[model samples]
Target: MLLPSRPAPVLALALLLPPLAAAAQTPMTATEFEAYATGKTLTYAQGGTIFGTEQYLPNRRVRWAFTAQECQEGHWYEADSQICFVYESESDPQCWAFWQEGGRLKARFAGDPDGTELTEVEQSKTPLACAGPDVGV
Candidate 1:
């Protein structure tokens, strides 16, 4: 005799869940990015190693630094479905596509030869430390 099965319901429930890979693939819009990053400092890691950290300030302004390195002041803007950043040290824009998954941010550099990708390892409300000219009293 044919009987009800749990596998069918489980399969249906699984199908109802959003695809995490696809969600991660879709880049966050500028508004979404700003809402997530503004007033927060985020640390990123690459290949399981600490890469750098950035503090997002008001009006899209930012301060970025490599591990134990001096910070660079920059600003970010949206350009053709990508977020582009310009730093005082480098005029050339560095573009990236950013997304959030599992409440963490991920970034992929545009036109990177090594296919570099960064994952946010930590986030905080504290500001970044920049010890140099134009920083602190």
Candidate 2:
């Protein structure tokens, strides 16, 4: 005769542990939000290194790097969209997107091979000078 196994309790404990740990964490602050927002240049390193610099505007919105090919005009955003940047593609106009998750900045390129990815670079908190009439937070 074979001995009975006791693995059911161990399996149940493993399944229930992570969710309990996650629920104990606190939400991030506004200052923390801004720091993560203007963190660093998001890059694609697979093919050739394509760099995109990001900065917080005076209006609390974010701006990204502009290039002649991928990004045009260096202005990036249009006034009518209220701050959303447009991503251009050969097939159709793609929406340039960004958001914060788990206190990190994430970006995505539309119609591109890669999906949204977390930036590996650390964010710095050095204050930037305001250029126009807009106010700071």
**In candidate 1, where is summed lDDT lowest over 10 consecutive residues?**
1-10
Instruction: Score residue 47 of candidate 2 by CA lDDT.
Output: 20
Error of 1 at 78 (Å): 0.4
Q: Residues 1-137, candidate 1, lDDT per residue (tens digit)? A: 00011212223333554656533489889999999999999998766677789999999998998777778889999998888988888768888889887889988677564345678999999999766765655
Model 2 has a clash total of: 0
Q: Estimate candidate 2's alpha-carbon lDDT, on a 0 to 1 scale.
A: 0.35
Best by lDDT: 1
CA shift of 73, model 1, Å = 0.4
The global C-alpha lDDT for each of the candidates, from Candidate 1 onward, is 0.76, 0.35
Top-TM-score structure, candidate number: 1
Model 1 spans with C-alpha error above 4 angstroms: 1-24, 133-137
